[model samples]
Target: MLLLLCLSVLSQAAKAQETWEVFMEKIPEHLQVSLLIQDEEGQTLFSQSADKRIPSASIIKIPILIALMEKVENREITLDARYSLQATDKVGGAGELQHLPDGSGITFRYLAEEMIRISDNTATNILIRAIEMGYIQDWLKKNGYRDTQLNRLMMDFKAIEEGRQNYTSPREINDILLNLWEGKWLKEDSRAEIMHCLKGCADNSTIPSLLPAGTVVAHKTGTLDYVRGDAGIILGDKPLILSVFVENFESMEEAESAIGKIALKAFRDFGR
Candidate 1:
């Protein structure tokens, strides 16, 4: 009995070592990586640094979408509410809406879709400015999300890239996605619409590219060089909510590839 117990303990240790090794090796040396996978049935399959605080990049839009949906839920904003493009709202990087002529107008709902699906910088800031930053802050505090916030509009210049205000963690973003998809964010239809929009997200660099093509993942990708992030719901034969945030990568591709490796691991292990 003693010898058998010793062998069992050794096996457990070896398994733990392997788990840590996957994270340590696939995450890249000296990079900050937070990976979390929660079965889509609403159970956490894997979590590490999933909640660890880190820079959000475009992943911040996940919360921004929630805030906007709250406005819709409260009847504070209408789906058809028309918004005109503002020069001040435009931010450089990752989107084309900024360069479109100022006369273009879109509905509040469409803005939310564009912002989350494409990580459209201009659309995100515009919606945030519409809801007012304070509203988003208050919503975060009221909800279960303790570590998510937008330090500024997508491109406040002084705040996100150079300022101390902009940052978030993998766990927070994952929770946001889970709540959004779990039908907890808004009325039934509203929640469905939000998830539907996120499902259409165009940036498929991280989780989307890594998973089986038919697998439905409603996720967004964030990148600011050395830092790359993707957080969303991964629906396979068995669904899961996952967040993979990598910082200090050598390049955008490196960070993205790191995320792909971790996601592939989860898919293999959790789905099997």
Candidate 2:
């Protein structure tokens, strides 16, 4: 406990030493970014706006994946359970499956896999609707997560238009990832399933793209016109949990460059 506490303090001290405006003045223009870097033991090695909430994008799928795995553990639902979808949940971008002939008919487990592997918008919304709200909202609270929720399925036109994008902080969600990496967050069977699902993640442009070839990274990315985010575990002897969210950016080119640049520096600085 003392070690974990110390790590948290040191990580926060880094943030206190550099305020957002001051930090970004050197960073670049037109990007709202929050990042956190931590070691294999769940101790934060570095962070920027680590605990601040921002639009989560597809990162919300992480919690949804956990919830589905938990339900499977409880025998509340089986992986084999068929989860029928409807036209109401469809959203644009990243998922070819959503527009397929048989996309509406898929298993609960498949939906979980599709969301992570393809970053599927429709797949995410389908899983959200499949998992009961009580479980989705309560799971975070039970785990000491102060912020993060998968309220309403993704791309609910009305909801998204109303500015209801799912919100989460890098800190809270990173904690959840740390718990998973440490095998402390969920049941054994569920943990294995969750990892399996994450392994199939399709979007790999962030930290993974910056790392060495063949390095294992279990990460998820979220994107929209106004938001871009990627968060996950980086594998190495000095493994770190890292997440970058850039919102209200001026251009995709700049946001993409900022994510790569910050993560590269963060990984090196913390590991050293």
Candidate 3:
């Protein structure tokens, strides 16, 4: 019986390795891709350039969300607290918040929800200012996120031109998702709140794009002219933590399709 068990495990590992190799062959030669897939227990199922830091785009909002939740848990801030939108707070990006009239009143909870659900640039900026960038940075460092950084606000092109950019790695993001899955950092209520926002993500063109019609993916996506990424927990029989980032892509559709393919393959392979 022991011998059979050992052989079975080895066979499964070999099959998984082969599956990964086949997936790699399908990736375009010109794109820079970093991906990581892990089981619920933090075991790496597959990885490619998982530790390479790439431009975070809006995926940095996950850290911002967590940091804000931490403050809420500690009584440092309350979700009901409201902020009046200033003209300067508006930024052009993927969010309806920007379209709202200036001086509009918004709550911390609504801002948090929109930040993840719509990848709202204006909401993220408001939350960042409320939470304070220094606090979020210290929280990330204290929590052992070495490759993730929140250097500038969203849609800040001048800052980007000056070399200020947010960055995170697949491995680091996977770790964050795994921790959230295991309910590590926040209280149950807080975790559920964050998950609620993630599950309602408005952009379904990446990780959740090719997934089954009703699949539940609590994830976040980031995009730029040359960068695309998605990271989240795929909730199901074999719930997996998956993160995929692609940079230097010529076509946005191609990059998004690559990410969708990777996600669908992982779901089929690991969702057993």
Candidate 4:
């Protein structure tokens, strides 16, 4: 039994190494990718440019969700509190809230859900205003996410034009999922609520699309003209946490397909 156990461990280690080599060899030359995959015990299964900063796009919503939950924990805000939406908050992007009337009202919790599950730009704008971008930045720095920044509100083209875009590293993004998975800062109920919203994310064209049927992934995806990112906890026998970011890809479809292939590789090699 002891010999068999040792050999099994060796086999797993060997396979993990092979997976990394395969990834490096197969990754497209024209794209810049950053990825990190870790087991529940915090063992890094594979990593590439994990510390490199990348454009955040909608993935900024993850940190926004955390900041919002912190307010709820401190009684600064309640999930049921209705926040009025104004015409100025509406922005053109992936979401239904922008099309609604200017005077529409939605709960803090509902806006959060829409922000994550649908990457709703209007909902994100409302939440950012409610929580304040400075508070979110302070929370991030306090929580040890030095590489992730909530520098601008969603769809703020003026800010983008001035080069004040949001950013996060793969390692930093993976830390968010790791903290949620471990229930680090959030209470059990808060953690559950966040995961529930993440699991409901409607865009499955990237990582989730390539996973095996019935695989549970609580994740958020982000897309931009030149960047695609997905990060979350993969619920499986091994329960891996992953963050993948691709920038300067030739196109959105190519970027997404690359992410899909990377996810499929992780699932096939690590899933039990």
The 10-residue segment of model 2 with minimum total lDDT is 16-25
**For candidate 3, lDDT tens digit of each residue in 80-171?**
98889999999987899899999899989999999999889999998999899999899889999989999999999999999999999999
User: What is the C-alpha local distance difference test score of candidate 2?
Assistant: 0.76
Candidate No. with top TM-score:
3
The total number of steric clashes, by the backbone 3 Å criterion, in model 2 comes to 1
Q: What TM-score does each of the candidates earn?
A: 0.87, 0.84, 0.97, 0.94
Q: Is candidate 1 or candidate 4 better by TM-score?
A: 4
Q: 1-272 in candidate 2: lDDT tens per residue?
A: 99999999888767744643465577665567788877877766556778888878788888888887877777887888776666666677767556866536778777788889988877777666667766788988888776797666666668877766678898887888888888885778788888787766876676666765677778888887888888887666567788888877788777877877766666555643
Cα deviation at 240, candidate 3, in Å, is 0.8
Candidate 3, residue 207: how far the Cα is off, in Å:
0.7
* lDDT values for all models: 0.77, 0.76, 0.91, 0.88
In angstroms, what RMSD does candidate 4 have relative to the true structure?
Answer: 2.0
lDDT of model 2 at position 123:
77
Stretches > 4 Å off in candidate 1 = 1-27
Q: Please, what's the RMSD in Å of model 2?
A: 4.4
Candidate 1 local lDDT, 160-205, one digit each (tens): 5566565677767767776776777678878877778878888887
lDDT of 4 at 197: 94
When sorted by TM-score, best at the front, the candidate numbers are: 3, 4, 1, 2
Backbone clashes for every candidate come to 3, 1, 0, 0
